[model samples]
Target: MSADGGGHLKMYILIRESVPTGFAVLAAAHASLAAYLKFRDAPEVAEWLSGPFYKAVCKVTDEEFEKAKAFEDHVVLTESALGGQEVAIAFKPRREWPKAFRFYRLYRS
Candidate 1:
């Protein structure tokens, strides 16, 4: 979308809750950068980059991360230290926010 009719581009970054604060931040960063690079050419992402880029960092359990990977439009971040665990997930920017993500709140730490 072109940020018209109140449809703004937004990316959701979900990180594993059990990870340390530093690791969580790193994972979230990795996810965000990966998503941006992957979708940078899209019109919505380009608009977001040109204007105010919006992102939401949320906490997700390991189970949640696993489930989220099933989504087609997601980028997963893996960490070897965590035993090749999926540390974070970044969903492609969408005009309509997915209802599935309603449970995830903003990252506190």
Candidate 2:
């Protein structure tokens, strides 16, 4: 689903641009699971699971990654391979998000 598209509930996993591709892949997966586990009881998460369950894996700069932390409905993931640096964030599934979320580019090799 498009980030700005309406209807289906969605989640976003934003990985730092500095992380290597392979590690970024792993970070996205870990971040997804972490967010799901951490917010499994939330109404949005439950509704999301019952519906379309959309997700996006986007790339962001380190500055954007830090800024994402200001949003409360997310889980930040740290990679031990990268000396425990915060590498990614997985946001809880919801119907609405901050406008900046729509501009993050989808991660590509």
Candidate 3:
């Protein structure tokens, strides 16, 4: 819960820069769905799912992706097209945005 009584949960999707735009979109989608399903039963996740369910997609370097993979709350997405390389990482809903991930920028057209 937030000060204004709104849910503070938000999902963060990070796509590896090496991946092409099309593949990146697919990878992020897969990671997001997987994370949502994996945590759907939690109270905070349930509240987030029932309403706005905010999500943000950002670009990350290979090194950053590796670092994010070690987080317990994240899901790493890989595919044959990526030659077994991780294409994206999605984080479970968090009350506050992570400071360590501040360097990444939002996905843009």
Clashing pairs in 1: none
| Residue-by-residue lDDT tens digits, candidate 2, 1-109 | 4448786789999999999999999999899899999999999999999979789899999889888889878888999989999999999998777888888999999
Ranking by lDDT: 2, 1, 3
Best by lDDT: 2
What's model 3's lDDT at 7?
41
State each candidate's clash count: 0, 0, 0
Please name the candidate that would achieve the greatest TM-score relative to the true structure.
2
User: Where does candidate 3 stray beyond 4 Å?
Assistant: 1-7
Model 2, residue pairs in steric clash = none
TM-score of each: 0.85, 0.93, 0.85
Q: Superpose all Cα atoms of candidate 2 onto the true structure and report the RMSD in Å to 1 decimal.
A: 2.0
lDDT of 3 by residue, 1-109 (tens): 2312334677889998888999988888898998888877778788778768788798988788788777677777887876898788888887765566666778875
User: What local lDDT score does residue 61 receive in model 1, on the 0 to 100 scale?
Assistant: 83
